[model samples]
Each structure stands twice: as C-alpha cells, then as structure tokens.
Target: MDLIEELMQEITLNNFDVGSSTWVDVTYINNPHSFYVRPTSYRSFLKSMQAHGQKLEQQDLQLSMNIVYYSKTLKNFCRGLIYHVDTAKKNCTCDIYAIDYGCVEKSVSLKNMYSPLLEQGLPPLATHCQLANCEPKNGLWKDKEIDAMKCYIGTEKAKLIVKGKTCLKLIVELFNSCPDDIATMLALTGYSTLGYNENVFSRIPNFKQEKHYYTYPKIEPGNVLHVRTQSGKDLDNFYVAKVDEYYDYINNVNNLLAYSKQAQSLRPEDMKENKAISVFVPQFLRYERGIIQKITVSEEKALVQLVD
Candidate 1:
C-alpha cells in the first residue's frame, strides 16, 4: 500500500469508535449540519478526505493531517486534534475539539491552502461615473459634461484652474459688473482679446460695443431679448431677459446646455482632428443670479455661455 493508504489504515484501526456517543453524534447529527466528519467508517472517511482534498486544490493551497492519542476521564479532556496550514508563508494552526473520552483521534492533512482565491473578489477601482461608457441620468449637474470639460482642460490645465490662474472667473466677474456692451466690458475688464483677432471674445460678437444702426432699448427685467449674431443664422446671441420666478431653473438649464455643448463639441476627438476646442465654464457662476449674461466661445466660434 502507498504511504497515504498505510497512514489511513493505521488511523482507522487505532481511533475507530463505532459505539461511542461522540462518534454517533459526529456521524449522524453534526456531519449532516456542519463540516464535521466521523472517519470511523472507511468509506465515509475516504469520501470526506477526497472532498477535503478537492476543496484545497480549488483554493490553490496545500495541507496535511495526522492522528493524536491521549488517555481521558479527568483533566477536562485536554487531548485535541491539530490541523497545520500555511498562508502567505506564515504558519496557521487550527485545533479541533475532542468530543469523546477516547485514547486515539483522527484528522486530515492539507497542503498549500489558499482560500482567498476561492472567495469573492474585490469591487472595481473606478466608479460607474468614471467609466467611459457609463451615463448618469438626471442629477443636479451633468456628470458627463463636467467630466468632458475636465478632460479637455487636460491634466495640466486642470492644475492651473485649481490654482485659480484661469481667466474664466475674471470674465464672469466682468460680465456681471453692470449693463454694458461686450466690447466695452471686455476693454474695461482689460481683455483686449474681446475686440482683437486673437482675443477669446471674437467668437461671440452679438454683444459688440459698436453702436447698431437699429434702435435698441436698455436691457431690463421681464424683457425677453434674443441676442443673435450678425448673420442671425447662428444662435450665438445673448438673450437679455428677466425670469424672476423660474430664474434658477432657467439658469440650470442654460448652464447644462452650455456645458453639454462644450463637452460634445470640444471633445478630444474634435481637438485632435483640428476641430473646435472645448472651453471651461466657471463653476462659481454656474448657479449665480445676475444682470448681464455672458457667453464665451472657442476660436472656432462654438458658443459657451453662463446660464443665468
């Protein structure tokens, strides 16, 4: 017989307790409900050992077992079975309780038992929002638009923005100072770019400082003015109107629209292909109520606006 078979035979012959109450309890009661195995019967013991070996293999671990002996009746049954295992190169030990006053005990040996491999895995690192394919619907803010804008700024530009070095906040502050023409405001705000070719303001010309031949009235609350570009075909105009009741709603809707369009048009695909660039909308004014409305745009004339 093989060494394993010899060891099994010796354990079975020496520790077998066919008539003991503990053997009956382990075989009939505990084995049915728990992992307890009474190896007094050869067939049952071999089957249990086989199952245990399969379990260890599934977990990518190794283990080994042996029989112990002790005399009992007094001393609170000091004798118990020991199962030794290794995990991550560290020795781990488990003690099995002795249920009967027997001189011999039987146990199984297992090698390299890696239980973590058999357990459930960990959750993903990035959330659903972080995934490129995930779309979050109906939130206080559009996550996709925000994420796209972040991507456009690239990692470097984002650092500058975080440090408050970007011109977005300054532009918003200038637009909100008072009722003024776009060019005048830009000049007063020290942004020659508004009237110059390289200036960011050239994209939105509807609010130009140049006087119009058509008579225009002063902007006020309750006036729904459609600020359209010179060609009137492009909706790149600022509508100077008051929405006292639904001002918040209009602002949110407008900001979301602006960010959405910016994200879509200025997506990395468009930029890499020499298309339009995406602009970042200042977060401070994303929900602020104000007098003059401002729309910033990219060099390609794509509109970027403050909703309120």
Candidate 2:
C-alpha cells in the first residue's frame, strides 16, 4: 500500500453533523432549548467562510462546511476559522477546530479523501476538502485494499506461530477495551497478532501503525492452547487450558466485584486510584444521580447511571 498521509482534507458539509454532543464541538454556554438558522442565513454563512484563510487581498470566504447554532432564544453571532465545508452534504466539520491537537488530521484521512479518486483513475489531491456534498457515498477503494493486505499478512503470521506446536494456552480478557488494551492483547507471547476485537480490529492501521494483523480464529472455545515456559521446558512440555476457563474466571471476578465497594472501577490502573475499587470490586458509591458502581466488565457501562 502507499504511504500514509497524516491529515486529509476530506471532512465536508455532507459529513458535518449539527449538535454539540453529536459531531460539532462548538457548544453554546446556554443550552437554548430551540435553535434554528434560516437556510438563507446558512447559505450566506457558507459564502462568507469560503475565502476565510486566503488573505486580506483575496476577498472571498470559503463556503462554510459546518455551523452550530449557539442559542435558539437569542441571536448571537461569532466567527471562527474555516476548517472545511461540504456543500453537497450541506454539512461542515468545524468541530475539529475545538480539538486541542492543533486542528491536525491524521495520515489515514488521505485514504478517505482519495479512495474514490484512485478508483476514477484521477491523480489524488486530498490537501483540500473533497468537493462537498457533490457525490453520493462511494467506495473507499484504497482503504479496503489496505485492509485486505493486512488480512493476508496477519493470517500468514498466525499460521507460522501455530505451526506444529501449541503449548501453553493463554486467554486474556480485557478490563478496558480501548485501543491500548486491544493492542496489548495482540502482542501476546510467541504471537503478537493472536487477538481480535470487532471495533479495534477494523482500524488496525490507524492504531497499531502497521500494515497487517492476524488472529487465530479456529482456536475456539473448549480448545486447549499450549505454550512453552521458561528454561528446561520441552517444546510440548507446557500448561494446557480451555478458553471457557478464562471466561468463567472473568465472570466470577465480575461477581466478586459487584459486592466489593473497592471493586467500583475499571482498569487495573484506575482500580489502584479508586479508593472504593481498592476496597472492593463490584462496590457502588452513593451519589445524587444514581450510584456509580464499579465498571465490572466493560468501559461502556462505566458511568451509565447518569441519564436524563
């Protein structure tokens, strides 16, 4: 595959989502229950943004790719930098400006912007925004091809490690399934690619910065996984274990956590910091909005008690 480009100008009006919690980071200090910017006002706003960063001499505003109404109760106007606009989709990704990371996009973005161009046999120039809202959602050829490449490389690597040898079986349950944890499990002994998560597996290149990944799919439940130990251990002289054993252990641990006040945390690191979790695993803390119990299994259930 071609080299990665850190940031691609692909966010367009089509991709621009309106709402503080959804897409755009621009939020009104006052949550106006109702807000509406007339389409005409939106049209004008776009024109004014088109030539924003050009220069004082270049008197044109880059059409705004995004907009967020601060308040519906009062009309307040504030201007911000023109990051990108997508006219066809009638959306903008202005929320990126709020990112403290210097408004920089990543290398994988180029693939999103130019995949169609590559398909159309056109030279790729993703330095600027993809023509906004003009084309229908199309295939990401470059990105797909890259994933295909990774699959091939990963499968081959997995095969090489399991060749004629299965000693100590290791099954890891992630306490926190973030990118870091996903990557960590993938780097297990004897085989770095012996792990998979549906979400993190898709963005392997973005996270691991690698061209390939592999997983042992046939190593299913009830299957014994064996591995070699330290010195003096023969090739097959190792420990054997089943995948269900790991799950059962995790379930028991989760059960123990529920009753333990100190169990009220997620990751090992966070567990250390959480006085409650340090005391017990499944323990809960009494709060006004509902109790914040230990996130026994996954990160998604961490703070779900707070709901409006």
Candidate 3:
C-alpha cells in the first residue's frame, strides 16, 4: 500500500470515535489537556439533575459534570495527539451546543477553568501497559529538566501519559523493521534522515546504549530491538539515515576517526603547548546518509569515535 493508505489505516485502527453528529455533539477545545468533548455522555448526567427537581439550567447541568477531554497536541513538537475526559470543566469548552446548553456551557467551559486534577483511573489500554513497563519510575518525570519542561509547556499528567504512549509506539514500530541499525530505522520514521549529532540525549545519556540499543541476538515477535552506544551516552546526537546511506556514513566516520587520531599524534607538540591544531576534519565524518550529517567539533579533545 501507499504511504497515505498506510497512515490512513493506522489512524483508522488506533484513533477513537467520539461519535457522529447524530449521536454526539462533538467540539474541539483549545486546551492541550482537554481537546475534544462529546455531549452524549452528558445525557444521563443531565437527567439525574432534572430528576432531583433541581431547577438548574441545562448549561448549569453540563457544567456540573464538567466532563472535558484533555488534548495532547500542544505539549511538544513531536508529542502525540491525545484526549482525556476532564471532569473539572463541568461543560464542554467548545461551546458546541451554545443554543441548546446556554450560558452554563460558557461558565463551565474549560477555557475559564484552571488545570484540574486528573481523575485517577486506569489509563487507556494503549498507555497503561507501556507506561507501567517504562524504564524510569512510573508517573515520575525522567528528570527535573523534564519536569520543568512539563510545567513550561503546560503539560499535565494526562497529556504526558498520552504523549509517552505515542512515543513508545513509534519506537516499537521502528524497531520492528530491523533496518540494520537504529539510525536507519529512525530515518524511516521521518525523525530525521540524519542521525543524532548533538547532545540532545543529555537528559538520558545512557538511554541509547543501555535501553534503546538494538543488540538482541534475535528479534522475537512481540519483542523490540534497540541500539545503544557502548559508553552509555545519549543517542540524541544520532540521526536516522536510510540503510544504504548509513553504510557509507559508517565508513566515513571510521575514516574520520583514523584521521583524527593521526592528526593528534602528529601534533603532540601542539598538544603540549595547549594550542588547538587545525586538522582536516571531514565534513561528513559521521555521515549516516540521510540520518545524520556530521559531528562538528572545534575542540582538540575528541570525545566520540564513530563506530564502523
């Protein structure tokens, strides 16, 4: 099948149905935490309020339930799109049924509310298993930096859970292809045809070598393979390149490493003088085809060696 077809199929299978116009009044909310809402679930809740002989407005009734689903699109550039039911809204923020629901919808809309406490419940199936099995502590931010990012990006626990599951799935799927290495596989995922080049993985330096490495003897069905650096450093600098391109990149990095070593040996006197030498560094030393360009360095010390 074509790429579009494949994407459509994936969306059809994984995406949820908030319901149709006939059965549900759906509206999109701006808050990343609660992106969409369906009015159908409110039917029963609305009846309960009326049955109690409480002369509350329909908008008021909707506000009382405050059932809004959080949206996940706003967290990060590559974060997944997710939605969660937010009970605090007491009304759909989209004001979808303004005529039918009235001012109560406006009052209880998510826009007017502060971030609510995520309802404690079992996360969706797609998220629960992956999150439970995550390497770092469950529900804990990977680091203080990540926690700070969450706060700055206005991410809530619900959105984070959604984004985490999405990333995990992407990781799992890319690993399934077994495209020679992580860089090649990542290129296919469109993360970057180029492999990682910077200290992007500084937050989880050992993540690539230890956790993300794809060095399994055999990739069993239902099992994933990962590629990690030998030194347990971050893999964020690695870029995803096509398989064929990665082969060339591998050779280039090897050649550069040899040249770097030769240059260092020749300049032992310069090294003793504490002066940086202008060595002929290949622009594509670490080229991984479309995966990564090169690891550019002006420093005399070479910390990374490109693996063949």
Give per-residue CA lDDT, model 2, range 1-308, as digits (tens). Answer: 22122112121122112111111111111111110111111232222222222111112323211222221122222222223333333322211121111122211111122111111111111111111111111322234333422332231111001011001111112112233332233333212333234221122444544222123246757865632121235656543324334322221222232123222334544422122322322232221122344566444444333210
Q: Give me the overall lDDT of model 2.
A: 0.22
lDDT, candidate 3, equals 0.26
For every candidate in turn, the CA RMSD to the true structure comes to 35.2, 25.4, 25.5
Could you tell me which 10 consecutive residues in candidate 1 have the lowest summed lDDT? 122-131
RMSD of 2: 25.4
Task: Write model 1 residue lDDT over 1-308, tens digit each, in one string.
Answer: 75346544544343212122211111111110011122233333332232212223414322112222221322221222232222333433332223222112222223322122111111101000011111223322244444433333222210000101111211111111234422333334432222223322333435646321223347679966533111234457434332222222321222232233323343432322222232434542222322222223433333332322
Instruction: Give per-residue lDDT, candidate 3, residue 218.
Output: 46
Estimated TM-score per prediction?
0.14, 0.13, 0.17
lDDT of 2 at 185: 31
The residue ranges of model 3 lying beyond 4 angstroms of the native Cα positions read 1-12, 15-133, 137-145, 148-308
State, as a TM-score between 0 and 1, how close model 2 is to the true structure.
0.13
| Number of the candidate with higher lDDT, 2 or 3 | 3
Q: Is candidate 1 or candidate 2 better by TM-score?
A: 1
lDDT, model 1, position 254:
26
